[model samples]
Target: MLEPEHGLIRQVEHAHTKCWVCVLSCLLLASVYVGSLYVWRSSLPRDHPSVIKRRCASVLLVSALSPAAVKAWIHWADIRVDVSVWELMGVRLEGFVPALILPLLLTMVFYLGPLVHSAMDDPDGFTTELQSVLDVQSWRLCVRDVVWLRNQVVAPVTEELVFRGGMLPMLVPCAGPTAAIFVAPLFFGVAHLHHIIEQQRLQRDGMSVILLVAGMQFLYTTVFGAFTAFIFMRTGHIVGPVLCHSFCNSQGLPDIGFALQHRERTALLFSYLMGALLFLVLLFPLTDPFFYGAIPVCSLAPAPEPVC
Candidate 1:
């Protein structure tokens, strides 16, 4: 029904709008990436008197800027920011528990399965190994550390706010869910690569070791970034990924393939492998829109009609 010139004009406007969204998203991501490095490099030790204030200020700045950026993009794109913080950021109590539990359970099954299998294989060594692992002093030290609290809590919340909450939704309109999921996480993974610089500063490791470590970290974080992005898209909330990120930080990566020698250990490994496989198999159905009432059918566009 539109005239040729009118259609052409519309197309041009759409193209320009898309370009603006992409450019703004990139700028926001770049600022967060650079800002994170500056914060890390300039931050004092946890034991220092001014550490809390400095770190708090840095986090506050990023947190403020993230939502502001999101607002700007949504406005520029002529979209509505209708989702709540829980919906937008995924912080709902309903989803958060499962999000945290599943990953932790899987990690535990993978890492502790081998050790448990080893323990079962030799009852004599079980007590010693258990005692070594259960050392109250070590547990106490970890619990008491302020740095651990910051890493587990503050970092997860803020990083998710920036990467998943701010950058991802804006990207969905332009890139769609599939591309946005992986694309936003690429920046998230790259942000952590700064750790290699920190590592280099503190340790006298050769370039090879540093590079290897950095590469591994980049790979895993990028993979995890995809996962968090998927979770964000599925739940339509930021909390899901935030809690998951914190849990992942606390648990670290599982060391697999070490208990292959003994038959019992191998069996345990197989069990865990199967469990992980099952989780992967069910992940989609479990996260499907029909399963959660809180997940609304909405699009990144400004349409009055919802897009499921």
Candidate 2:
């Protein structure tokens, strides 16, 4: 078999234009995610499932739209580079399992852990507030509708294209992995800062809450972005971190500050164990070489030198 570097280089060279197109397509998809919500809000039914479906549809729409948008946009916008349908399928398909399945497993384990904690206090107030924040029927309903759409579909697609596909590749060769990981999330946080601002402005009926909700959302999303960036570096696939992130977010896990303070306690050990296990689900492929081999991602080799 030919060396992998031979294939990697050809892959990069052939797909370079499509890569840029993916990055640009993210911006368009984000607009769609936000815009569709605004345009359809009044028309959407107030029932839990309907509300959740519309929101989830928006997210899935963004995920599904990125590649198609990129293909059309690149064909018209960049005449210098050519991209084949196979390459498009390769990139998107490479993303599917990690983006979808892994997160679901992690969330299941994460919630189950808390349920086992005898001292684990249910935040009914937070739960009620969260349901209102999502404008959905129930927690389970929101999970099926909003989270499945946003994290699994929209967030992974848009975020991976911008960070791993666009920003990381541009910086990794020049600044190396450490720098790329750090820098990428800073920009990712910046990209989604508007979410924080929007959440703060949201007032549902008479339930006026403090501005902390916005701050929390910003902090949470940024933290998620940082973790996702690291996963992409470790696994050489944007899918890994995207799965890791969606899992972490959907479970409504506590922040690092709380996790650390409780790290040494035995009573709270189950929660930590569950959270750790959830994190491991995202790392499954990396830990299992056989599984890694099954996925179509860039090799973990240093970039091959250009032939003179």
Candidate 3:
């Protein structure tokens, strides 16, 4: 085989250097983000409106400034992609609706049985639930409620912007789409560890219990992070991840045990299996980048994989 060109070898060396910087910058970003919540000297529980609002302010600022991470990336003289941070962060207008709709719809399909169960458990009855959907007062109350707004909108948007939008751009160019999906989420997972501090402060649980819960949370969030990262890579747009994040926050995790114990176990079990099967079956097809238009970020991939 012929020797590689000197310029090609030097370019590869520069890319390696940039990847190292990305790794460090991502860790620093996660540290500052998680650190922000504790900066307030509040004695109140995390769920307290005042505390929630302050933390919200802290995180949103971090997200708004997250583009700075890209500046760190381009510090390497000849290695950077010369793309805007917003576009690198998957903020393009192409494939807007499908990015908004299909991934969230796919997640809901995975939670079909649990969501139906949740709706069925609404004691106010279907009519009341329907009315509530159309109720301006209810909408206003949700808007006014800091916790509701944080959960349904602010957290999802900010977290996705930071973990997916901000972090993925740095990581994709370095690790490529497949590896970045798994790698970037570890920061997302570790950033969630701050929850243990709040729970411990409240004395709501013993040390062991808090640690155990935090560990489990880390696992779950990391797995979810990978899924959102996967969606981000495939669509190369932040909208899908944000919508899916918001829906998952609203639904919580699927209550597999509750479904197992329900009176309609037969039908519910069928749904549980079928929904999962369908989700797995459609995961690739529904998320095809061709359907969403050309994904700009796939340029960072080492090779053109199907999802990209």
lDDT of 1 by residue, 24-137 (tens): 776666577456545644434444536644665677677766666666666677765567533554545555555555544543443455445656668787776557567988
lDDT leader = 3
| Global lDDT scores for all candidate models | 0.66, 0.50, 0.84
lDDT tens readout by residue for model 3, 84-121: 66887888888888888899889989888776676666
Ranking by lDDT: 3, 1, 2
Candidate 3 Cα deviation (angstroms), residue 146? 0.7
Which regions of candidate 2 deviate over 4 angstroms?
A: 1-29, 41-51, 72-180, 183-211, 232-246, 255-265, 269-291, 294-308
lDDT of 2 at 73: 54
**Any runs in candidate 3 off by more than 4 Å, and if so which?**
1-12, 122-127
In model 1, where do residues sit more than 4 Å from their true spots? 33-53, 84-86, 91-143, 261-263, 294-298, 301-308
Which 10 consecutive positions of candidate 2 have the poorest summed lDDT?
299-308
Which structure is stronger by lDDT: 1 or 2?
1
lDDT of 3: 0.84
RMSD of each: 5.1, 9.6, 2.4
* Whole-model alpha-carbon lDDT for candidate 2: 0.50
